[model samples]
Target chain A: METLTIQGSPKTPTVEMDAKSGVIEIKGRSIPENSIDFYKPIVEWLDEYASSPSGETTVNIKLEYFNTSSSKCILDVFKKLELVYKKSGEKGVVINWFYEEDDEDMLEAGEDYQSILKIPFKMIELEE
Target chain B: MTFDIEAWYGEINKGDVIVNHKGVITNDLITEILSIVENKLIERKENTRIRKKIYNVMVEALQNLFHHTDKLPNETNDNFGEKFVTFVLKKEKEDKFSYISGNYILKSRVKFLKDRIDQIKYLTHEELQLLYKLILNNNEFSDKGGGGLGLVDIAKRTGNNFEYFFHENKKDHCFFCLKILITN
Candidate 1:
């Protein structure tokens, strides 16, 4: 499968999905006016990637801020990943949720997602 | 029982007005407003935590206003155009900022909107978090792509109850105003 890369904008995040390295990273802000439209393609890519499973998948989510709309879309992306993980015998998929040290809100957001999903999540704190 | 939108708008447009926009709301406009507010907050050397909270709340407030605003009738005397929304961001103190947004809604919808806000008003932070997660996990997004999580998220971030009002207008419409304050 071809890699999916979308450059970040002021209102959206940078997304990179590579099938070869089994790495998917979403960085920067995600406050798109129409989040579904922005994330639809990424979700589709993941669906395709789920077919030919990667040996080990590492997903990194580093976002400064995202609106409620994007939050739902992010969850959709995770749900797709969860499917992949379950099909892969629940061993090789991991999500790294990166947040600034002082951003209690981001930390809580990651925790919220962790509580909802069965996949493993690492809460990585960065220096402000 | 007509409400004076102009007067109410004037009341809120006071003290260090960072942004005062009143007209049609579009996606482009929302983007512009967010950037402007973000830059102003950064320029003031505001705390990063408070800045993100304010920005997040503004995104929800503006998008909610964009989605739920009622179009004005053609024959109305009110100059408020179709999809009219007015929002003001002002600095109330050194570390306090206020965001106020107003838009028209059909009178019939007031009860539902009121009930929703009232339900959120009494929720403690923990309750709000639980409600937020419940709604987020549910696949019941509105026709407008809203999962009904905006207000809850705003309340959770601010850790304060919502202060809202509905003023009746003559043409079977009411003006809904929501006020949120972010303090350091």
Candidate 2:
């Protein structure tokens, strides 16, 4: 219903979820000490958003770096969105994964998520 | 058998010392150390790719030390505080950096830790990537919210086997040392 916006910190990323726009963006670093605590609310928000049925949903993930713990939490976020995609006839959701020019690790991270999930991912490379 | 924390600390605090931290490890401390090291890497004019890799590896290393450090054995007479851990980041060469971290672990975990690392040591790059993805997708997280992917991520980025040692202490504790190198 309401937009969920979290400011980015030194150890966490900025998250924005807008129900009206059907867009979710998570950008910046995500290496929190307790990732589940940081991500729990966002996951819950996604759970709530899944029921509303947006016409189209776009997710953008542009992370410079994320720790292993955050990695799992991120996967959870994707899995939740995958459900949203499946429920919306499989064509209403697309994920835009952005990686810096030479960040092979980040690129591969996106690829890993793409392979594991059943959503369409557009690997967009950004020039540094 | 006894392990001397001070002696071991001194031995690893060699080379072009960049960041040498000891005593308690906390979330705020990790943030501060990462900021300091990131600034230092920038000052040294490291390329973006290497800088991010080192930063990523350092996060996992420090957090691993933060989460997995065992309480100091009662018999051990060391001034290192509870949940004590240490890490040294030093410049090994113009295009290389080394990160060495140490912490205590229960003797019971030695075999499991050893076997896990041994299994990761022999994996090729592609195999390591596959393993990392597999573990990432797995929902099994430790009570501390760790997905057990830290070591795999480290090995994958470094492209090097882990250089580690365990020194037995009195009672059921062992001091663990892990060394990782990042190069262009």
Candidate 3:
């Protein structure tokens, strides 16, 4: 599958998704006015990745902050990944949530996502 | 309640001001203000957790101000112009930060806004978390696409009651104000 790289802006995250490399990274703040509109392309990218099925996919989420509207869009991205994980069989998928060591809120946020999604998230503490 | 915008603005301004922005709020403006406040917070070397909470809730507050601000002009602010919204972040005497936002809102929506605030007023942080999860899991959003988890998340992050007051102005409109505190 083709790679999807959306450079981060002041209000959005830098999204780099290369299905062939099995690397997906979304890092930065998400506070878009129309989060659904901003995330539409990313969601579509994930949809295509689900069918292509890469081996040992790794997803990294390193967001500093996201508005409530973006929260829903972020969840949609995770839901799409869950679909890929469910269908990919033994190829496997590992989700890594990176949080600043001093950031308890981000740590809890990862836990929240893990509770909802079928896949277990690896909460990696970011070194200062 | 008669909400006085001037008095409210004066009250928050008494503190050591961190950010004081008032006027038309646009997407680009929001981004600019966010980065400015973020850099200030980091420069001060505030606690990591508190800074994150403050930053997240501040974004929510700014966006809420931008979206919910009513254009219904009050005779007083009409000449001043701009569907005006005010956001201020100030440092208190202690290690406390105050995030407050003020904007003109329709008198008709006071009850609706009040009901939502009151519903969460008595809820503990854990309960608010449950409500947040329920809202997120249930796929709930309003017709305007605003039935968001913002208030719940704000309350949970701050671990404080959301304080709000409404002042009915002269032009069939009121200024809705929200204040929440963050501790380091």
In angstroms, the error of model 1 at B145 is 1.4
lDDT of 2 by residue, B96-179 (tens): 889998888999999999999999999999999999999998798899778899999999999964699999864778889999
- DockQ each: 0.75, 0.90, 0.60
**Full-model lDDT for every candidate:** 0.89, 0.90, 0.81
* Each model's iRMS: 1.0, 0.7, 1.6
Q: Looking at model 2 chain B, report the run of 10 residues with the lowest lDDT sum.
A: B72-81
Two-chain complex of model 3, DockQ on C-alpha atoms against the true structure: 0.60
Clashing pairs in 1: none
Candidate 1 wrongly placed segments (more than 4 Å):
none
How would the docking of model 1 be graded?
medium
Every candidate's chain B TM-score = 0.95, 0.95, 0.90
- Docking band of candidate 2: high
Among all windows of ten consecutive residues in candidate 3 chain A, which has the lowest summed lDDT? A84-93
**Model 2 misplacement above 4 A:** B74-77
Winner by lDDT:
2
